[model samples]
Target chain A: MFLITNEPLSVTEVEAVVADPGAGALVTFTGVVRDNNLGKSVHYLEYEGHPPMAEKAMAQIGDEVTARWPGARVAMAHRLGRLDIGEASVIISVSTPHRADAFAACQYAIDRLKEIVPVWKKEVWEGGEYWIEGSTAAS
Target chain B: MITVQVQLFAAYREAVGARQVPFDVPQGATVLDVWQQLQATYPKLRTPRPVAAINDAYATLDTVVQPGDLIAYLPPVSGGRSLIPSPSGEG
Candidate 1:
């Protein structure tokens, strides 16, 4: 399962989507909004995404994970709109036959999501705001 | 001449002050050509080489754009967890 929503992200919901009886290990990663960036106090974050393209990119990441780690199931979700400090903005869950594969695949999923997914976040600071540039435009 | 719609996001959207832009260009114009035209029209578009997307897919500057194409000018992504530093040694 891959999605982009304006609702709050839930790790349990993401984990359930990737749960498999055959899998002995499960790993999940959640991205939370931080209060400060580069020594500047942040009020909140606003995320925007191209839903169709972002979903396609996320599904491709899941496919890549399954190809690399056999028997692995992956699910991911990214939140849109304004998110306050400590709010969960993104969640990824992976289940595999072993813990090693689960850990690696989960990490890879988030990394690939950031690299290819068409999601952008704007950091609203005390006085001003700027869009955070994570990866290069071509990445 | 061909007419294409340009979708702007993030800073690009803010710069243009509109979500979509329409351009009429020569039939053989490429994606880069549309970008050049945009720069000439909107001087506030400071990013000389913004990312381009055709029909919701990532596209190159040299990609040929067809009539009625939905071209998106995307800004850089900044929402990944990698930007955050970990308290422990492991990131």
Candidate 2:
């Protein structure tokens, strides 16, 4: 259930999508907006994404996870538009037959999402704003 | 000549001040060719070549573009939890 939406994200909703009867462990990771960054007081964050491509990238991440950890299920959702401080910007859920696989796969999903997803965040500070671009070089 | 739809996102979009633009290029023109043309038109696009995609799929800069294709120039992504600091030192 890879998604890019303007609606607020929910961990439970994402978790439900990856629920598996045979799974022994489920791991959910929620990314929330922070109030401060780089020593500046952040007012809010505006996220923009190429929806189709973002979802494709997420699905690709899921494929990678399943290949590495067979029988693992992954689900992810990313929120777009204005997000206030403490609001969840992204959620990832992974279910695996073992706890270690669930934790590792969940982490991999978020890390890969950051690398390949076509979503950008604009940080609005007290008096100014700037688009934040990740450091990873585009391959 | 082939015409392709060029899409920009994030800083690239802000730099161009538009989300989409149309470009006409000779047949066999690659993504790099379109990027050069884009930079020429919008000098503010001073950032280096970014991740490129065609018709919603990731493609190399050397990939040849097709007419009416959607070519996206994606700036460095900032989604999910980022452990690395941004180029501007503000992640």
Candidate 3:
């Protein structure tokens, strides 16, 4: 499933979907907004998604993941609009017959999304704000 | 002839004075190529645009660009721990 929401994400819901007895492994990744950056204190964060296109892009990514690992269960959810600190920004869960594939696919989802998803985020620091888009430097 | 459509988000949108921009890309233009040309014209547009997408996902230069293509130029996003109200929404 592909979705963009302004509401907070529920990890329990995500876990429930990927929970399958046939699956030997399950992985979940949550992206959250954090306070303080560089030298600035972030008051909040804003995310915007080109919904229609984002969904299409996500589907393509899903297709790629499946092709890479057969029988992999993949799901992704991304947050939109302004968010408070510590809120979930993105959630990805992957389940597979083996733990290895589940781990690999879960990571792949997060990595690919950073590169291709048409989502933009802006940071509002205490007293100031700036819009920055791109993947986390390390990821 | 392939017409390319470009959309600016956040600061780029405000900087360019609008949210959506469409242009006819000369046949066989890559997303990166369009980015270079647009940057050349909109001098204020800065570098290290943390991310980019064609049709809403991370796109590559090898991705063939055609007329009516849509590209998004995004400034590097600031990742903080919280969500706030959109400043633009403020009256």
Candidate 4:
């Protein structure tokens, strides 16, 4: 599944999609708005993405997953606009027959999204906000 | 003839002085044509930015544009949360 939403995402929502009988393992990752970064207190986070480009990139990622794991199920959602503190900005869930595939594929999806998707994350910090470009962050 | 709506985001929106630009190209005008026309019509676009995207993925002049297709013009993703309003590639 590929989605772009403004609604707050929940683990339950993700579990609903991943609770498949055939899959033995489910892996999910959520990127939240951290309260502090670079020694500043963050108020909120704004996730800006090139909708058209980002959507296309997401669909392509799904295709890549299918190619790698023939029968695996993949779902991804990204939140846009201003997100309050502790809110999930992005979530990815993957279900595969094996635990290793589930872990690897889930990591692949999130990493690829960070690397290629035209999404930008801005940290709304105390006094003023700044876009966080954590060098260690995956695409 | 087909009309494709292209939205400019961030720097592109500011440079063009507008949010969305409508390109009414001949029916079956490839995405490339729309891009070239933007440059041609707006001499200011003579210096094209990085790559362009059609319906999301990276596209070139060769990509086709449909009547209702929404194309996006994206600049490199930086930390700036460009509050440029609509017609930004994301809208």
Candidate 5:
């Protein structure tokens, strides 16, 4: 269920794809837009992505999780375009036979998604806006 | 010469003022060549090197560019709290 959409994301939708009868636990992670960043009051965020490549990267992450945790199933969805504060921007669901595996796999998915996904975000504030590059180093 | 489509996003898109552009490069030119040419054309593209993908797959800068290929130069990335956490746990 790796997906990229301009519409709002739903955790239930993503979780349904990873539902497994053998699974005892399902862990989900939702990344939401915040109102403040770097001490500036954020107005909103605009997400842009290469849809095909982004989904490819996400599916690759799922494959990694499956290989790392043999019984785990993973599904993810990421939303694009203008998103206001508190809106869900991304969701990752992982189901596994044990709670530990489900939790670990779910965290790993989000971390890898941030690292490899071909998506970018722009933070717009009251007076200005800046593209977030996810690097702390000066650009 | 070969022509490839260069896709830019985020800062790269704003810097170049175009979402995508068609570029011409000599045969056997690598992705690095395309980056250099873009830098020469748009000095505002300040990032020295960014991750590149060829035809929707991750590629090294040295990877050869193919005619009609869709090449994307990604700025860092977004989402997640922080890319690097402080070792000392103090800001």
Candidate 6:
């Protein structure tokens, strides 16, 4: 399951999608807004994206995990709009028959989400705000 | 003239002061041409070379613009990395 929402993210919501009786391990990762970045104290964060394309890209990541590990199930979601510091911005969960596969797939899911997803974040710091230029993905 | 919608994100959105805008370009104008027009209108938009998307799919600067096309200008992406091959040749 892949989703994009403006509401706060719920870890249980994502974990439920990866619930599998046959799976031996489930790994979940949540990316939270931090209080500092690049030596600057961040006050808050604003996230925005082309919701349709972002969700489509997220689903593609799920498909990739299944193709690589046939037994793995992936669930991921990203929150859009303003989020206070320490709030979860993204949540990813993966289930597989082995702990190693579950862990690996979960890592891969988050990395791919960062590279291909259309989401962008603006850091509102003490003095001013700036849009972060993280990856140079032209698409 | 062919009209197309330009969708901006992040800094590009702030530069143009709107999330989306409409532009009327000359016939046979390409995606790059539309971007040039935008730069002319909002010089601040020249900060980054954003990835272009034509109608929700990845596109190149050389891609031809069609009437009523929606061209999205995406700023640099953060954190997310694609394992698959992207149109821009990045991972």
DockQ of candidate 6 relative to the true structure: 0.50
Model 5, residue pairs in steric clash: none
* TM-score attained by model 1: 0.89
2 against 6, candidate with superior TM-score = 6
- In model 1, the runs with Cα more than 4 Å from the true position are A135-139, B79-91
- Which prediction has more favorable DockQ, 1 or 3? 1
Q: How would the candidate models be sorted by DockQ, starting from the highest?
A: 6, 5, 2, 1, 3, 4
Cα misplacement distance, residue A21 of candidate 5 (Å): 1.4
lDDT string for model 4 (B22-88, tens) is: 7788887876677677877766665454456666556665777878888777655543233222231
DockQ of each: 0.31, 0.34, 0.16, 0.16, 0.36, 0.50
Clashes of each: 1, 0, 24, 6, 0, 6
- Best model per TM-score: 6
Measured by TM-score, how close is model 2 to the native structure? 0.88
Candidate 3 lands at a TM-score of 0.68
Q: Model 3, range B1-91, lDDT digits (tens) per residue? A: 5678888877777667777877666677777777777777776677633256676555655577866667876654433211221223110
Q: Write the per-residue lDDT of candidate 1 for residues A26-69, one digit (tens) a residue.
A: 99999888898777888998998888888987888888889889
Q: Which lDDT tens digits does candidate 6 get at residues A9-91? A: 99998999989999999999999999888778889999998888898888888888898889999999899999998899999
Which has the higher TM-score value, candidate number 2 or candidate number 4?
A: 2
After superposition, the stretches of candidate 4 with alpha carbons farther than 4 Å from their true spots are A130-139, B1-6, B10-18, B21-48, B55-57, B61-71, B78-91
Rank the candidate models, highest lDDT first. Answer: 5, 6, 2, 1, 3, 4
- In candidate 3, residue B91 scores what lDDT? 9
Model 1 gets an lDDT of: 0.84
Error of 3 at A38 (Å): 2.6
What C-alpha lDDT do the candidate models reach, one value each? 0.84, 0.85, 0.72, 0.70, 0.86, 0.85
Q: List, residue by residue over A1-139, the lDDT tens digit for candidate 5.
A: 9999999999889999999999999999999998988778889999999999889878888888898899999999999999999999999999999999999898888888887777788889988999887664121
TM-score of 4: 0.69
- The better candidate by lDDT, 3 or 6, is 6
Please give me the total number of clashing residue pairs in predicted model 5. 0
| Chain A only: TM-score per candidate | 0.95, 0.96, 0.91, 0.86, 0.96, 0.95
Candidate 6 displacement at residue A41 in angstroms: 0.5
